[model samples]
Target: MKRQAYRPILITDASRSQDDQLTSRQRRYVMMMGVRVACVIVGAALVGTRAPLLWLWLPLVALGMLLVPWLAVLLANDRPPKDRHRLANRFRAGQQTDAPAMSLTAEERPHKVIDGEP
Candidate 1:
């Protein structure tokens, strides 16, 4: 007799289950480093070859050399924007978002006496 096995169920939430191993900061650092490598390669290649209008290309090379690291560092240090969302039922219901305006009538306002003796 042959035995059969059932398929395993995937019950995890899709968003979390498929999340990247790297955090946002790590991802940015990785991406910026990749771009930085490309910049270095291109700059070296440009300087190595006797390309025409070298003066025109000099600024590009300069920018890559000077800006790439600064930008990479900046981006790597940046944080992902915070997410803000309100539950549909919790909002616009009895949940008070704003303070109710005080009633014009004095009776509506409660008075507290310090009762301090001099």
Candidate 2:
């Protein structure tokens, strides 16, 4: 049996690639906002009802509302905020424009041998 040498795949320019990457804080802020909004709506519904669950819903709703400001602050305090333009420029500078498509070929690809070690 003959061994076949494998060549590495290279991307020449990555700047032109279209991809979305959000920082941790940004993702969290978005998630928190969505949850808060849902909570507010639910809470309002509970408050308007004469059901005994109003007690529970009101507090939950209030807590959710309270979280909005805190979440905003957290988002504001993010050490490195997400910047789409900057990230795009960086992608361009790094020559990573068109990213590879997600497929089994990517996941199942064999690892390259380094330093001639198996």
Q: What TM-score quantifies how close candidate 2 is to the native fold? A: 0.41
Model 2: per-residue lDDT, tens digit, 83-108? 57545643775476543433224436
Provide the TM-score for each candidate, comma-separated.
0.49, 0.41
lDDT of 1 by residue, 13-51 (tens): 123222352366577777777777877887677788967
Error of 2 at 81 (Å): 14
Error of 2 at 113 (Å): 39
Where in model 2 is the C-alpha error above 4 Å? Answer: 1-22, 80-118
Checking candidate 2 for backbone clashes, the offending pairs are: 13-97, 14-95, 14-96, 14-97, 15-92, 15-97, 17-97
Q: Which 10 consecutive residues of model 2 have the lowest summed lDDT?
A: 13-22
Give the root-mean-square deviation of each candidate in angstroms. 17.8, 15.4
